[model samples]
Target: MRMAAGTEDRERGADLAEAAPIIRANGLSVYYGTKQVLSDVTLDFPSNKVTAIIGPSGCGKSTLLRCFNRMNDLIPNFNMTGQILFDGVDLYGPGVDSTEIRYQVGMVFQRPNPFPKSIFDNVAFGPKINGYEGKLDELVEQSLRRAALWEEVKDRLKSSALALSGGQQQRLCIARALAVHPRVILMDEPCSALDPFATLAIEELMRELSEDYSIIIVTHNMQQAARASDYTAFLMGNEERIGELIEFGETRQITTNPEDERTEAYITGRFG
Candidate 1:
């Protein structure tokens, strides 16, 4: 399919698992009651690649991210028009289960939101609720290890998650998402709340995780996006507060040589 004039084609890259996109948004627009948040935005998230959504505040970055997993449906008066395809299947089509979509497409929020339960229980919660019959102990350990937090809290599995540091809590949240064995992971500013060192840790973890899972992240940090992502989508909000996709392409190109003047302006710190 031919992309719009300003949109970039899916570039061949070593980080992408396949040329075909795992998630495709066709003319996607989102509204909250009478207020339109995102207008006719279309983009693709390639398999096994880190796609960063960057823009100024209120540009619908998070709203578009939430649409992938139907997380926006939780908000009252939220609605949208467009087709979000996951592996050629329309996520909003008839008979599509939002719960099942969330299972396959997990999310990690800007803040670490671990349950008040123990560390082990936080990782085990998803599988338990899904009626997983596998060895829960093994699953917990595997998830924590994948999130690169097992060694830190391995001996304290029974300890409260709230007791861990902020960075640890965020990794625990990622581990919780991984516990469900999701095919895609949606992260909304996963490192926003962390210190520089913690943020770098999360970035490193994202690079490692992208080897196995397709990742879409919404971030305000230009450096983080350039350093961690394989592809980038730039969104901008107008005076009416409706967000539009200004540019989309490989991270290096988007960062170093953007096609759109607005994208270049934003990336070069002229405006946000």
Candidate 2:
């Protein structure tokens, strides 16, 4: 039976409120040199769930996602203020190793970006770099299975990743991220580059993965956010081009009964 939207929202809210957050942001802000992109954004990403960040273009959705693993550090002159805590540790604290943080919080790009190596090699790369002492072949198979791509590519593990279809390659990328056993996975519009069937495949994979890994995705697709995520954060930019979190809550409420009128307007196609 289909539940009423309010009933679903209330149930989900109660459940999520009790779950411990795997990552918490406090007064988070991002800047590229002199330009501020994200301003005073704060939110909690609960463990073993999918949190989707949705906003119009230039709203810094991707910027906030990169802050999780400190990917923004790679960009020159990029800086931030405030705390991004992972498992109670400040990500930007002194002596923190960005490399280790990245291993714990892996990222999947918008496009499928598998290396020019074979399918087996693509999945094995991370485990190899992180110095996995166990059997390499087993880890590769396990990662592929977790990404829901093992059956299709088991026979062609040696084939070049480029030889696979677009969806297969994206799954291969996901399998690569899983090989490292990351606690949290951040995806930036993971389905934006795929066909409808491929997009659905990724969404299904996300649902299954949430059982073991906390997933955070930045997406512009409203319907996708409504369908795939457990929680939704709506962000909007001000006149000065600084993005801020306007509303955040269970996906059902955020989509059906957003507390902020701006969020409702954007979701209803009135404006972005």
TM of each candidate vs. truth: 0.95, 0.95
User: What local lDDT score does residue 249 receive in model 1, on the 0 to 100 scale?
Assistant: 79
Q: Local distance difference test, per candidate?
A: 0.91, 0.91
Instruction: For residues 145-188, write the lDDT of model 1, one tens digit per residue.
Output: 99999999999999999999999999999999999999999999
Per-residue lDDT over 176-228 for candidate 2, one digit per residue giving the tens place of the 0 to 100 score: 99999999999999998999999999999999999999999999899999989
Q: Pick the candidate with the highest TM-score.
A: 1
**Model 2 misplaced regions, further than 4 Å:** 1-14
lDDT of 2 at 158: 97
TM-score, cand. 2: 0.95
Model 1: CA > 4 A from native:
8-18
